[model samples]
Target: MKAALMYGPNDIRVELTKKPDCPEDGLILKIMAVGLCGSDIRNLTSDSRKGNYPFIYGHEIVGCVDEIGPKQTKYKVGQRLFLFPGTYCMECDNCISGHSENCENEHVAKLAGTGGFAQYIAVGGEKIHYGGIYEIPDHVSYEAASLGEPMTSVFACLENAKIGYPDTLVIIGAGPIGDFMASIAKTRGAKRIIMVDLNAHRLEMAKQFGVDEIIVSKLDNPQFAIDEVLRLTGGKGADKVISATPANATQAQSLHMVKKGGLVVFFGGVPKGSMTELDTNLIHYNNIWIKGHFGASYDQSKRAFALACSDDFPADKFITHILPLDEINHGIELTKTGEAIKVVLHPWDESFYP
Candidate 1:
């Protein structure tokens, strides 16, 4: 099997590795397509996974069941599938309370050096029974199905905010995740959608994706975006604000961008051990609600897959580049330069590269 192993920060090499064996109670997937996520870039640039170096790390996976375990009865060989990525213990306190998304003993199926970056990954043990795999629909393209995992988080965030008709939704970040937030919010009947970002080129590209307005934020003058959001909302502020960038400035600006009694979702996470100073008076005097979102629930993952399968979701448009597995470094660079929206890597397609 050929896998891209992360040796350290900003270092990745593609080399031959032993193929993972199928778990007695699990299965092995021949990875077809895997989408590069923002988290992957973050991990690549930092030592967050220092001790776990030289391991595979992709999670937005779409593959075919190459080999099935004898104990696995639900799926058959050669069936195409999408990964939910994370699994949880049913006996955990969070799982018992029906909030398995917060399970204390959660296990990521992509871990243990058998992630989607490889040509073949073995998913076995408790992960199969706890829910991390779903059969892909025949009509959905592999590239689109690879986006299901990221879309699940978007669905979870919107569901938490209860965004609906006549709500002015503002998303801070013009990347793929922010675009997903805008797309889902539109389907939920948001009256107006505004996107803010530091990249002017990214914001220009976002216009075709159903964003009602785009604000080019200034890193030096952070208040410029706040004023622009207020001006666009007729001085009332947006009804809901989602800080989709992993920047402390944007996260703090979300509070001032939303109207009184509105909801603010911190969709992007800041660096570990870093804290932002926010005005508590805004929450106390204006009756604001601030929420922090992380992973998605099983139900949200299912809904995200169904939505990706639908014709209305524009899943294909989200994919801007497709590359071979060996070119993983180039793919990562494209994402960092904002030259690509979503890059899907085909682990087995060594002959084709774009």
Candidate 2:
């Protein structure tokens, strides 16, 4: 087996490694495609997670069941599947309260050595069935199936914000995740979708995904963007404001872009120990809701899979570049440079298109 192992900040090596055996109560997957996520980029540079070193770091995964454990009756050999990377302790208060994404103890998929970056992986954790894996639909492309993980979190954000039709939705960041958020906003009843990004190319891409308006973030004057957003919303601000960028500036400005009594979703996260100041009076006087969302649960992952299968979702469009595992480093660089919307890696170098 071969895997891209992250040794430290900006250090990842593709090395031949011992293959993991199929767990007696779990399964083994021959990885087909894996998508690079923003979190993966952060992990590559500097991640504050507990299991943070000398591990593989891919979560958006699609693979074929190469081996199924004796007790794993829910899946079988040769089945295409998308594996959820979140491991939650069912005994946690968050899990018992149905907020398992916030489990007191969470082990990301990569921490267990089953990161999708590898040619093969073994999944056998106790919480695997809870929100850790799903059968990829027959018609879905491997690239599209790999998106189930990120799309699940996007769905979670919308669920938390309760965004729907007729609401003006403002999304800060026109990256792949932001594009996914725009794609489903109209379906959720968003009357007008406003997308913001510093990149002209990404903002242009957002236009194709049904964005009603586009605001280019200004480097010289950050408040200029917020003023433009307010003007676009008729001085009332957007009904739902979502910060999909990890910039502390975007997160802080999200409060200023939402209408009174509206909701603000802090979808993207900044670095650990980072802090931003917001107007306390603004939130108190406007009665606005500030929500934070992270990984998705089992049911949300299922819904995301359904969304991937829908004709309107256009999951394929999200995958702008595909590369063999040998080019995985280049793929990661492309993602970081904003040169590709979604960069996918094929561990087997096989045909991945539908």
lDDT: which candidate is best? 1
For model 2, the superposed segments whose C-alpha errors exceed 4 Å read: 47-52, 70-72, 88-93, 104-114, 125-131, 350-354
lDDT for 20 in candidate 1 is 84
The 10 consecutive residues of candidate 2 with the worst lDDT sum are 105-114
lDDT (C-alpha, whole model) for all candidates: 0.86, 0.82
Q: Per-residue CA lDDT of candidate 2, range 1-354, in tens?
A: 989888887778988888998888788889999888888888877744555677877878889989988887777799888877776666777778887777777444333324778899887735455556678778778888887778889988887778897899999999999998988887788889999889988888778787989988898888988999999988999999999998889988899999999999888988878897888999999999988888776567678778886786887788889887777778778777778888888888845331
Instruction: Kindly report which residue stretches of model 1 are placed more than 4 angstroms away from their true locations once superposed.
Output: 107-114
- Compared with the true structure, what per-residue lDDT tens digits does model 1 show for residues 1-354? 999998888888999999988888888989999999999889877886856778788989888999988888878889998878767665778878866678787254233223889899887766777776788988788998998888988988898789899999999999899988888899989989999998888888887778999999888998999999999989999999999988888889999999999999999988988898899999899999999998777777788888988887998788999999988999999888877889999998876556
Number of residue pairs clashing in candidate 2, backbone atoms closer than 3 angstroms, sequence gap of 3 or more or interchain: 3
lDDT of 2: 0.82
TM-score of each: 0.96, 0.91
